[model samples]
Target: MSSILHVELAAEPAAAGRSRRVTGRWLTSLCGAEQPCATAQDLVLAVNEAVSNSAEHAYRGDPSGVVVLHGTADGPRVELEVSDHGRWRDPPADNGFRGRGLDMIEAVAEDVRVERGPRGTTVTFCGTLGQCSGTCEP
Candidate 1:
């Protein structure tokens, strides 16, 4: 059976750190030995990056902003959603800084989706988990 975890927290640097730790623990508990060492590491890195994006770009760095995380861990498939209650935009083609983090997330995730508008931004990532394979190859 699949499960889902949904949560919201302050979009601050400190909160970002906390979210990373929490996600690591949660993934470990949920996947156990079925999740390989390398897979765990990648998940951790991806979670941290997502949280960092929320803190840095969410609300454009507003002190009281909040980011929401929701996802599921079921057997070999783990999915996550990181959302910010802030503004979002497609960076100008001429702009160099453009969507690097979102791009990075897409590269790491086997499947990804993004929703952007005046209300907020949400980035979702998912990959497979294997008992004998901890790393994703693609």
Candidate 2:
């Protein structure tokens, strides 16, 4: 069986934390066990980064932007997509202590896709739910 989690929140600073908490709970329930899936923490971390990115950069100075978080788990695979309707922002040239979110997401997820257009941006992260197989390296 497959399970889905969907949440839409204003693109604000606190949205990241809210998304993380909701995702954690959804993962725990989806696992159907006392503890969440083995990779749940990593998944949540990656998701937080995505939501944070949207909350920080998507709307620019506008506060009316909306960010959507959608997740699905089926069998051994889990996929999440974080999207925003606001215009995309180019990363600053001198990102001294930031701009590592995409790299971090790529590290944890087996597959990552980012789409940007007039409509907005959507970042998708996909990975296995349990222990890594031959495809994943420690």
User: Which residues of candidate 1, in runs, are more than 4 Å off?
Assistant: 34-36, 92-99, 132-138
Top candidate (TM-score): 2
**Which regions of candidate 2 deviate over 4 angstroms?**
131-138
Query: What lDDT score is found at residue 69 in candidate 1?
Result: 78
lDDT of 2: 0.82
lDDT of 1 by residue, 85-116 (tens): 78775566775765576667766676778888
lDDT by residue (69-108, candidate 2, tens digit) is 9999886677999999888778889989999999899987
| Best model number under lDDT | 2
TM-score of every model versus the real structure: 0.79, 0.87
> Which clashing pairs does model 1 show?
36-134, 39-134
Question: With candidate 1 superimposed using the best TM-score fit, by how many Å does residue 47's alpha carbon deviate from the native?
Answer: 1.9
